[model samples]
Target: MFAPRVALASLSGESDAEWAKACARPAGAAFLGGVAVDGPTREAARELVDRDREEFLPEDPVAFVDDQLAALDDEFLRAGVNVRATGLEPLREAAAVCAAHDAILEVNAHCRQDEMCAVGAGESLLRDADRLCEQVAAAADEGAPVSVKVRAEVDGVHLPTLAKAVERAGADAVHVDAMDSRRVVRDVAEATDLFVVANNGVRGREDVFEYLAYGADAVSVGRPSRDPGRVRPVYAAVKEWFL
Candidate 1:
């Protein structure tokens, strides 16, 4: 059986202390720096295209980049924070930040917001698999374990292709945004030798177990982290089932 591990969702805008509290969760194994390359909210994101029309290019193409990098740096400076991993764009600065922090770096290719695509980040990489592979390889060459996070397509044809490409790119793992049912996710996992982590819609112990059984090496929980009181029980349950 795969051991259950926790990943905290969306911490890019949060302060270091806030990130530390989430990382301190006993079951937590990784932290996704929530740098929404797109707008922070749905309504804001919808305005991205219209907003872009007013400028020659997207306004503040990387508006969120600096803040996200700062948050990652802050997390790194905290003592005994145990933040072994983080996710970011595979840019030179992002690679540098991950190296300085001694954290495994994951490329964010799962974001589906229009703003992200408009700015040529996130799922936009899916359209250019070779470049994405090159970027991941570059990060790996820099002594950081490069993982790529990708959303599973609705039709499922692209998932296998993306998984295989990441594996060939020398990535340490592939984080699958498994918003679909557990059964569908399991089918995708069966096709890859690379380490797989399931994210999206994982609410509690049973969901975690279902993911593990489906071949996820780890599972990430989102909303549960907002309430600190819920972390222990979830951690305890994971320990009970698969530790």
Candidate 2:
């Protein structure tokens, strides 16, 4: 599990290694740099990412992932370094890079972008539980710690069941974008043994404590952590809670 119990969720714009490093604090872990893979399944992801998101495409995704992990060499030595990535083709490859670099590799299943779903990446996996489980299993098999980031409410998808699936598939942790539902985090926590990292709408110390009270092992900060001043209070609260 991550130290201090505070995590920087894989916010689209903030996920680059450089940006994540800049945002890192002594008490929290920064989930750095998300990458898209090569293949037709990535076209829609590319289109969607091109609009407002900062997505990275390296000719070799494994190298790109390795480079990103390597970029955080100094930070890795001092704090936890985790990477969140999408795309079906490179879970194992990315996991390998993470293993090589001693970083955590998180599979992104929380993105609900229309374009991402159109390409069968992102939250589309929520609708395809079997495939997602397989991907996570493969990544975990690569000898790297794997965390699956999943959305709570997605119409027909059952959050607790998916959490169980991820745990059964060997994922070390489950990162939940709880959205407006703290109950989903509770349910997932109850259903699985995996460490639960609660994400979404975590604005202040209250939100952090609220999620932890609901059974989250850790809490992730998204939009609010974008401001340096905002990070201190949240970090202090998390540190205090852990203490």
Best candidate according to lDDT: 2
Judged by lDDT against the true structure, how good is candidate 2?
Answer: 0.73
What do the candidate models score in CA lDDT, each in turn? 0.56, 0.73
C-alpha positional error of residue 50 in candidate 2 after TM-score superposition, expressed in Å? 4.6
lDDT by residue (tens digit), candidate 2, 1-243: 767677876666456677666656633566764456546435654675668666665567677667777777777322222333344446777787788877777877777777766667778888888878888887888888888888876899999998888888889888888878887898988998989989888767888888888899988877765665676677777777777
Instruction: Give the count of colliding residue pairs in each prediction.
Output: 1, 0
Model 2 misplaced regions, further than 4 Å: 49-52, 76-89
Q: RMSD to native for every prediction?
A: 6.6, 2.4
In candidate 1, the residue pairs with backbone N, CA or C atoms under 3 Å apart (3 or more residues apart, or in different chains) clash, namely 12-34
Predicted candidate 1 versus true structure: per-residue lDDT over 78-191, tens digit per residue: 211111111234254445555555555677676565665555556777777776787687677766666777777644337777778878887777777777655656765787
Name the 10 consecutive residues with the lowest summed lDDT in model 1.
77-86
For this target, which candidate reaches the highest TM-score against the unseen true structure? 2
TM-score of 2: 0.90
